[model samples]
Target: MASGLGRGNGAAAASVQLGLWTGDAIADRFWKFYGEETSTRAITRLQFLEHVGYLLFLKLDHERAQRAGRFAQQPVAPVDAWPNLALLSGDALHTGLTTLFDELGDQQLSDRPDRQTASVVFRDAQPWDLDRMAELNKLIVEQIDPYRWLAVPQAELGRAFSRMLRDCRKEIDSKIETGQTLTPLPVLNAITKVLGVGPEDIVIDPACGTGTTLIAAYHAMLAANRQLPPAALAGADLDAQMCRLAMLNILLHTGRPFADPAPVRLADTLKRKTPVVRSGSGAVPTVAICNPPFKSNGVQPDATMRDDFWAYGDFPTNFLQHLAITLPQGARAAVFVPDGVLSGGGAAATVRQNLLRNCDVHTLLRLPTGLFHRKGVKSNVLFFTKSTPKPSGEPATRHLWVYDARTGNHHTDTGNPVTEADFDDFVASCLPEEGFAARTESKRFRRYSVAEILASPKTSLLLKAHLTKELGDFGSPKEIAFEVADRLDEAAAHFRQVAEALPGQ
Candidate 1:
């Protein structure tokens, strides 16, 4: 837990002990207005909650500005600062929000902006009906207070608050077949560290889901003492709802809706052009970090791409390939990919070959099963950089390091939560001063020359692919048979999904 934050009490469950919330408690808050309602009601209410939260945060922020002239000369940061909104009547809040909404689009106010200025973002915007306005005000009053919300991270707080309004699984499933699962915090920390992102870099998450990766990157930049605005980081997703959520997620988490807006493009990154950013370099960047939709199966085509990713494979393979080929020279990337992308014939091999021959393919951290909400998802994070193109016939990956953190690092229950500590060694090893070149071998971490990788059957990059397994050695015959059956079932599900998406089924 973050210091000073309280964990939920088991003995005092009946008592009103505010501020302490267990993981299940948090999840319950998310499940609130979401699961049962009709789609329209669910999403609208959820969007309303986000709007109200943004307004509430701004109200608190403006209070700091008001108090600066009285007791403090400088504005206060939001870390522990609290401004009581419980006192604001429903009418007063409705009026205050209405006024701010007008100013957000006002040309005169644009000439001389203030911190409390409005932010008009795209996606499911707030509704102006009186019933919703009244409901939003009451919900805010009943659920929010200094005691309960002062320490909550905005993204987490936003999700919890919105849950009371809607989960809208149907609305979500229409966009993503897989349940929307966040990139676990441990995975987020490790990937952020490995990318070596600094203040000077322009970052992007091509498949930013609710903007978790982008928001995490924002905090990382702040930790690095970078004054970069929210616009420095960008995200793109095929879902319009997510685009809007990404915009709101960034705003609420950073407490800076007024920061110059970054483009959260609502385009399939694999198939369409990203929105133009103000950076004058269009949409490509210094660092591309993504846990893209692992299941996008569209037979998408692109003639303009400098490389033929389709000739290489399918939805996610091409998505990863797009990021690899389009990343500006010298830019860095950390991508979460399925095990299939590492090896296999046809397009997968082609894409792997291009990555090895061109990009300096460096680290491959093969993730464990059960790391995601999607059980049996065997994933990996491929960390590489797009530097100058390699010479003809020269492989860009001279030597590649692989880290296996899967076999023994299993999370079978909630109490034994996985965390960033589990990946400490891998994070430290990725340091620029002691990267793959300085790394040595271990049972969990190993290295292979480019020749070794290409010489492996089918250019398979998975380091443990060749490690032979002894059958029925650890368990009784019946137990071993069950285990083999389980493995087959998991593989069947993965391949079946792929087959369902093929052109002819």
Candidate 2:
């Protein structure tokens, strides 16, 4: 565990002063920021999030400036951004932002070789609000009360900004043709707990949308007092804007120590043959957790991995198989894949079989619907360990535990959002260090032998026998007696048959 987390000068306590409606207010303000042009929610949200993400970085930079004050004498440092933010108006907002954006181009300390390229590369890679900074200032006043609401601690601002953007993601579900759902904070934390992520351990999220998994991992290590540098984290995204926001998110959470290379890279995991992460301690993902895009252009589940070529297929399935195959031997991963990956036929079935044969398949927690932006889509987290070469007949996996959190529990993006507390039992049961060997079947959690999974024609991971959908929780006395009697009678008959068939008899 890392030490001295949450001890930063600008770090806020558990209780932040932001209003309950602050996230909603930010959402409402963004909609208003774009007048009555009435574009698709997807585009509108991208524009809004782009500006807001930059704003978060700007706020942190301003706080850094304040901390660097020089006795209010000998003229303030040339890079102070807070002084202007206080009296920010149209031109002031633009000037402050422009100066900040321009400063990001400095390659004085960049790790890249090309000094000029490193300076402007970050800005030039993504779409900009530089030309429209003045327009955003009007939106800030007409919508976000920048002076009043933006004065919170840098950490709080980042959390609030992230929450608002996730809320907006719910509205863009219909407009988006691709899959890029945000992982709920509680779920992300629970995953970290299950993985037992350490400070020195290398972590990667290949399908890192806005980098929530990586962000959560960062905080987890921080909370554990495990002080990890940006080198310990890596993430990649197909979208440029997502990569940019993820970069900002890492910058915000690792506050005060803002002098490191951004670990996020912009790349499509499926399209790239090589690694998506360009610079880290290494390209290997020791502990991988990703909610990769689930669909392949709204097409069928035809992703393939034969003869060194695959034109198209289920994206999530391909990513999962890729993670399992590419991860270093003995590496473990927790993948968020749709339920189809569990029982779907054709290439999916082959991949599932391969995963089972090679990996030490541990647990499968069926996630509830409404947990993602995709409505009515059931998902599951596959926890497995990659093992080395073994005998042909012997399988790496033996007993498998399946936790059915989705059956009775329910969650939503809003209203009743899932939190870390919601995953208490699931986390306890799924963790291998927490007496995993002594685990037994609970009401919502059950243990299945690997034989049972292999016996299934589809290699289906569904394990809902004890679920409410199967048997009544509180059966009548007669029903209980009958069930017990049936078990005893069957056992007795089997024993009698075996006894009669003995050679002596």
User: Who wins the lDDT comparison?
Assistant: 2
lDDT of 1: 0.59
Question: Once superposed on the true structure, which residue ranges of model 1 sit more than 4 Å away at CA?
Answer: 1-122, 126-134, 141-175, 178-180, 257-259, 272-284, 304-312, 412-416, 432-436, 465-505
* Model 2: per-residue Cα lDDT over 252-342, one tens digit each: 5554233345577666665544335555355466788888876534333223523322323477788787677767886768999887888
Global CA lDDT of candidate 2, please? Answer: 0.63
Worst 10 residues of 2 by lDDT: 1-10
Pick the TM-score winner. 2
lDDT of 1 by residue, 1-505 (tens): 2334321111222333334454335546434523433243534544544555464554445443444346432332232232433444466655655554444434343344332223324233443454445555554544443222334555555455334322432244234343244666677777877887777677888778677787767767777764675556887766655665666666655655343444465565666443222334344478888886665344455667434453546655776778777777888888888888887678888788888887898889877655654234467899888867656768877888888777655542133557778888777766636544577676667778999888988899867521434121223343345346645654777799789989983
* Model 1 error, position 456 (Å): 2.7
- The TM-score between candidate 1 and the true structure equals 0.68
**Which pairs in model 2 have colliding backbones?**
2-224, 2-225, 2-226, 3-225, 3-226, 105-119, 303-313
Per-model TM-score versus the true fold: 0.68, 0.71
